[model samples]
Target: METTLRKSDEHESISDGNELRHGSVVIAAITSCTNTSNPSVMIGAALLARNALEKGLKVKSFVKTSFAPGSRVVIDYLKDAGLMDYLEELGFHLVGYGCTTCIGNSGPLKNEFINDIQDKDLVVASVLSGNRNFEGRINPHTRVNYLASPPLVVAFALAGTVSINMEKEPLGTDLEGNLVFLRDVWPNSKEITKLIDKFVSTKLYTKEYSEIFKGWDLWNELKPPKEDVYQWEENSTYIREPPFFKDFPMEKPPTTDIKGARVIALLGGSVTTDHISPAGTIPLDMPAGRYLISKGIDIDNFNSFGSRRGNDEVMMRGTFGNIRIKNLLTNREGGWTSYHPTKEIMPIYDAAIKYIDSNTPLIVIAGNDYGMGSSRDWAAKGTQLLGIKAVIAESFERIHRSNLVGMGVLPLQFKEGESATSLGLTGEETFDIYGIREIEPLSELDVTARGINEEELKFKVIARLDTPIDIEYYQNGGILHTVLRNMIKK
Candidate 1:
C-alpha cells in the first residue's frame, strides 16, 4: 500500500517530502490516569511500540512524544516486561509522573515548527492517551486534538498526520519498503492480558506506596515558616495571599440592584470554563504573560496558568484568557473584548482592569449552556476578582451557576424562548437588574438595557439562587464571606 498524502493548495509543504501538508500530529502524549491505571492498555502500548520498532517504523522528527504514567507502578511493570526500551526508541520517553499534557502542560513545540505553524496558519493536532482534549486545553498551536488509547497515540506519532484512516491507509513504510498498517502492530487482547497478569503485582504497588509520603530532596529543602498566619512573600510570583478576604466585614452586606453594568464578554453557546479560566500555556503577549515578564521572569520560565494558579494576580488576568475564546464584543476571536468607554479593542484582562479601576460593574452575556465544560472554581473566582457582578445568559451549566453564586456573582437566566440576539443585545448597552435587594430563591427580576441613544429595552430574568443557603451566601457576598462572618461570631 502506498502512503496517502493530502496535498495543500495555498500553503507550501513544511515537511521534507511534503508528507504532513494536511495536518501534523505535533504532540503525542501518554499522560494522566484515564488509560495509565489500566495495565492492559499500558502494556498494549509498549507491545505496539516494540512491534513498530522491529519493523523499523520511526515517529516523525516533528512529533513531540512523551510518556507520563499516572503511577510509578506503571514504570515498574513496563521495566519488568522489558518493553520500556522499545517505547523510548520510538520517542515515547518518560517526561513526568502525572497530569502533563492532559492539563495543557504539553509545553512549547520546537521553535522551527512554532514559526511555521503561526506564519502559515496551519492546523495541527495532538493525540493524547489522557482524556481531556478540550479546545485550547492542549497546545495553543494544535487546534485539533483527539483522545486515543496509548497505542494509538504512538501510531499517530508514527503516522505524523491525523488526516488518514488507520483502518486502510498505511502509517509508514518499513525499512525493507514493506507497507505497515495499524493491524500489523496492534497487540492482541490475550497478549495484553497475559502481560498484565505477569508483571502487575501487589509487590510493585507496595514499593511505590511505601515511599509516597517521603519527600524528594528539593521538597525537603524548603524551610516553611512556623507562624499560624502565613508570612506572605512580597515578590513571589508562584503564590500570594488572595484578596478575597481583604476588608471583609463581620456584618453581611446588603445586596444591591446592579446598575450601569457593562458586558465583558458576549459569548455564544457551549462557552466552557476552559474559555473562562484557561489552564493552558501563557502566551507572551497576553496580560498574564506581561505581568510575569514585568516581574522579571523569562519567557521560558513563565510556566502554565495552572502552575501559577495560587497567585491571584496571574489567575485573575488569565480569566476568559483561552486562546480560542470568541468574545462577540469584538469582531475577532481570542480573549478580547471591546472596552466600551473608549470603544477600543483590547485583551479581556486589560479591559477588565480598566473597568475595575473606573468602578464600573461588569456582566457577561452569553447564549445557552454557558460555562459547560470543566467545573473549574477559578472560572468563578476570576470573575469575582474582575468585578463581574452578574452573568446573564439563556441558560447556565449547573455547577458553574452554583460556582457563580458561591463567588457572589449573580447568575441570571433570560426568559424562555428569549436570547441575546432576540432581545437585540448588541453588548454595547448599559444593563440594570432591579429587585436584587428583595430577592428570593428563583425570583423573577426586571432587566433594563439602556442603549447608546438612551433607548430602553426592558426584559425579565430569573435569579438562579436555588435555595435559602444560596440566598444567604449571596446576601453575605459569597460563601467565603459567610464563613468568615460565622467564624467571627463564633
Candidate 2:
C-alpha cells in the first residue's frame, strides 16, 4: 500500500455514517431484476417521480441517470403509466436493458464531470435502486454510493447528492428557498396502488411477454449453441467453456496437501462476491481485455464483462476485487493482489496469474456473511474461473454460498469470534485444510495457517456442505456442469 494513497473525499457506504455533500451524481439508475421485477415498487417510483415533476422539481443537470431494467417490459409499463416522461425529464433515460449500474456497465462518467470529481475531490454519491452497493460497482469516481428504492434514487437526483437523509430533511428548496420535505412529495401506498391498478395492466405481462418470448431481434441475434456442451473456442472472448468443467476429476480428494498449501490472499469482513468477481467495464488495457483483443476481438466491439459470462478467460481475469478493492495485507486501496508463495504483496489479479503460472492453487479467507446480494451465478463462476479452489469465511450469504458450491468451490465457515484477522492471518500465509473427505453439514475440519515464523496455527472451520446434493455438486465440478451431465445421461 502506498503511503501517499489519499483517502477518498467522501467515503460512505450505504449506511449513513457521515455527512454527504451536493455535487455530481455520476450514475443515478433504477435497475436490477430483483427490485424492478416487482411492479409495485416500479410503479411507486414512477408515481413519486411524477409527483415531484408536478411540484416543479427538476433533476440536477450533471446527474447521469438511466433506467436499465433487467427485462424490457418494465419500460412498457412505465410508458403505459405515462410516467416515462417524468423519469426522462429527471435524466432517468433508457439505457441498455440488462444489469447496468449494479454490474459496472455504468457506461461513461462524462469528461467534465470526471474532471470536476477528480480535481475538486468532489463528494459524490450514486443513489441506485439496485442490489449490491459495494465500492466500485457503480462508476469508479463516485465514492458514497447508496442502495435505496427507485423513488429514493429519483429523490437523490433531485436533491443532487446524499447531503441530507431523505427521511429527515427537506429534499430540496424552492425559489423562495422553502424546504421540500420527502413526506410532502412521497406518495402513500394507497395513492401508488390506485396508479398501479389504473395504469399497470395485466396485458403488458401476458401479451407483451408472449411476443417477447417468440423473440426480440436483440436476443435473436445472439448465436447460442443448440448442443448441450458449449463448443470451447480457442480464441473467442464471449463464450469459452471453463477448465473446471472440462473433464474434471470429481473422485480425487483435495490434492496438494491442504496442510502444506500456500495462502494466496487474506480478506476482510463484508467482502461481498463483487470483491470476488467484479462485474464492470473491462478496461481495454487490462489482461482480460488484452486476451480478448489477442483473440481478434475489437476493443470497440468488446462488450462489458457481465455480457461475457460464458467465457472463462474474460471472467477469470475479471475476478477478485474491482479496481477499488482494498487488500488489508498490503494496505493498498484498489485492485486485487497476487501474494507471493511466502506471502509478500503484489498486484491481486497478477498474483493469481502468478499462482497459475507456478501451478499453485488459490484460496480466499474472509469474515462473516460472505457473498451477499443477487442470485448472480457469475459471483461463484468467476471465482472458480480465477482458480480459487475453496472459500473459507466466517459465514456465507445464502445465495452466494450455494453459488460457490454450485461452482464446485468449497465453502467453509469459521467458528464464533474466529476470523482471518483475529487468527493473525495475513495474505502471505499458506493455508491448509484436511479431512475434506469427512466434511459434512456443520462438520469441523482442521485448518492450519503456516506463517513466515515457521509456526503452524491450527483451528476448526465449519464445512457448509449441508446437503447430499451439495456434496454431489462439489464432486461434479459445479452445479451447471452437474446439470449438463445429468441431462446427457437422461
Candidate 3:
C-alpha cells in the first residue's frame, strides 16, 4: 500500500523522493444524490478545489478520482461559476451525472495497484460523498470506506489518505515548500452562498428539464417491439423475463404444513440486504460471474449485479453472496454454506439449487435485527426463488419483513428471549411448522425441530403476516400473483 514516486521528464512537478504511505485513498468520488443534489456542498467542493489550485497543490497520481453529480444542472452551475476547471485540475473529472461509486459501480482499479495490493495484503480506503459506506459495498479491494462531504472527498484525494487528521496534518506543500493545511483551502459559508445565489437559478432548471424526455441520440435510435406480449432475448445477459409466474396455478393451493425443511444459511445479527444481495462489481470467480462467462462474456464485461438484476439467473446466483457475509454453518467467511445432504461446503447458491432439485423446502435461521439495511426487494425475491419458504429470526427489519411476506416467503419471529443461539439450535435439524393453513394476522404457530439423534425441540413462533392484505398476498402465492389473478378475473 506504499508507492514511491520517481521524477520523470514528462511530469517534473512531482518530487522524486515523495512517498505515499499506507491507507492510500484508492477511490475518491464526489458522487451520490445525498450530497450532489445540494448546491451548497457542491459549491463548497468547487471552491475548495479553486483554493487548492491557487496554493499549487495537486492530487496524488495513485488516487482514483471522479465527480458524478446527481443532476445535470449541477454541471451547468459549476461552469457558470468558473469553478469546474479547478476541480478538473485536481483530478475530480466528471464521470457521470448519477450514482457511481456509491452503488459499487466505481469500476476496476489499476492493474499495477491491484497486483501490489494483493501481493502486500494491504488495506486500502475510499472516501466518497455517499450515504452508504457498508462493508463490501464499495470496491472489493477497498477494505475501509469513509463517508465525507464533497469537499472532504477532494481533500482526501489531494492528501492521498484518510489516516491524516485534517485538523492538524498538512495535506501537501505549495511551490514555495510551504506546508498547506486543510484550513487554508476550506471554503467559508458566505462564499458558498454567494456562488449558489449567483450561479444556480430556476431558469436553468426549467431549461434542463424541458429536454429530459427527449433522450440522447443513442437512446432515440433504438426501437422497441410493438407486440402485445414482450419477446425475451435468450442470449441477452442483462435482461430476461422473470420466472415468478411461470408455474402459476389458476386455483389457489391449500396452505400445508412445512415439513422436513432444511436450513440454507445460518446468519448472525444486522444482516443487511447488501450482504444478502450485493450491488457491486461481480467477482470473476463467483457463481454469478461463472454464469456470465458461460454466456461468452469476458471478465471485463461482467457488469454489477444491480445492472443485471432484470435477469433472475444472475440475481439468484448472487443471493447471500457478499464477500464479507459470515455463514455460521461454514468455518470460513463469505457466501459459503454446508449442504446437509452431502455435508459438503459450497456456495450458498449451489446448496440452494441442490435443495431445490431434491424437491426440498429451505428456511433461513438468523439472529436479531435480520434484513436491516436498504429494503432491497431482491433480498426477498432471491430468497423465494431459492426455495426458501420461511425466514425465522429473533427480529426483522420492517420493510424487509413486508417484502418477504409480499414474495410469499413466510417471515417468522422467534418468541421473546429466544434465538438460534439461546435455544441451542445449531441449524442442523429438520424443521416442521404447523398451523400455516389456519394462519391469521399475527397468529402464533407451532414449530418442531428434529435433530439427527431423533431428539425434538419444540417452540412457537409468531407469523409476521401482520395484516389481512398480507394474508391475501401469501394465500395467492405472492402480491404479484394476487394482482395477476385479480386482473384475469376482471
The lDDT per prediction is 0.89, 0.73, 0.88
Better of 1 and 3 by TM-score: 1
Taking the tens digit of each residue's C-alpha lDDT, what string does model 2 give over 1-490? 0111122544442212122233445567898878888878887788788788777777766777889887767888788778788778777788877778887877877787777677766657787888778877777777768788887788777766555555665666655667777777787899778877887777777877788668768888998879996676766667665676566543433423354454555667787767667577777766777877888888777778778877777777777747666666666766646466555555566777777777777887877778875666777877776678888888899989888988888898888988877877775677778878766666788888777787888898888888989887786777876787777778
**lDDT leaderboard ranking:** 1, 3, 2
lDDT by residue for model 3 over 49-123, one digit each (tens)? 999999999888778899998889999999999999989998889989887898898889898888877887666
Worst 10 residues of 1 by lDDT: 1-10
Please give the distance, in angstroms, between residue 471's alpha carbon in candidate 1 and its true position after superposition. 0.6
Model 3 spans > 4 angstroms off: 1-22
Report the C-alpha lDDT of model 1 over 242-306, residue by residue, as the tens digit: 99989877788777999999999999999989889859898899899999999999998998998
Residue 32, candidate 3: alpha-carbon lDDT: 95
Error of 3 at 3 (Å): 23
TM-score of predicted structure 3: 0.94
lDDT of 3: 0.88
How far residue 462's Cα lies from its native spot in candidate 1, in Å, is: 0.6
